[model samples]
Target: MALKMARDDLTEFLAAEFPQVAQDFVIEDVAENRIRVRLATQDRHLRPGGTVSGPSMFALADVGVYLAILAMIGPKALAVTTNCSIDFMRKPAAGADLIAECRLLKLGRVLAVGEVLMMSEGGDAPVARASLTYSIPPE
Candidate 1:
């Protein structure tokens, strides 16, 4: 499918609609069937053991898929997550940026489904995997 929004467009949309997290994440790349994003690791994202927290990883996955959907459907602020399933497979490296690769599985009028694989900045193996469903708002 053709893309409806590019990285700069999404960045502006997020800045206007979700200002709270606008500075935390960046849209790295957007393609026909894939998207790559990175989280600007911060102290608050760290756990007691100096690793990225689970919630942080989950957030990355969720937003990554959401952005991928919006990239196909255009900016829809009301598009909200309805369900998510995340699996933590390995420990993320401390002080390393986290990258999320997302692909859309299905995109319909009312719902969208996608998957994300998250890995450390320079790692080969995914540290976590997630599937997310979002409720697309009416036009």
Candidate 2:
């Protein structure tokens, strides 16, 4: 399906709906079935070893998939994650931003499945991978 929300639209939706952490993320790119999101890493997102925390990476994956779905289906705030499985493959680069490349694997009427590959900005290997399922709300 064609995207219903572009980067600007998604950015605005996030800022308006989730102001708390909206500034932490950036909608870098949006396309037919995929999105690239960046997490502007800060002190709060890091762990004791100066690497991005697991929870912070998970948040990036979750938000990445959520935005990709909204890009295809419009801003459906009610759409929620039903399940997620994330594997932290490696420690993120110290003090570097993180990026999530998300692809929508399936977009059904009531459900959507997406996969996210998380990486440290400018790094070669993936730091984490996640599979997520979201429940789309009824119209």
TM-score of each: 0.97, 0.99
Model 1 spans with C-alpha error above 4 angstroms: none
What's the CA error at residue 114 for candidate 2, in Å? 0.2
Cα-lDDT of candidate 1: 0.91
Q: Lowest summed-lDDT stretch of 10 residues in model 1? A: 31-40
Which candidate ranks first by lDDT, i.e. highest? 2
**Top model by TM-score, which number?**
2
In order, how many clashes per candidate?
0, 0
Q: Tell me the tens digit of each residue's lDDT in model 1 across 51-104.
A: 899999988998898889888999988899999999999999987889999999
In Å, residue 1's CA in model 2 sits off its true spot by 1.7
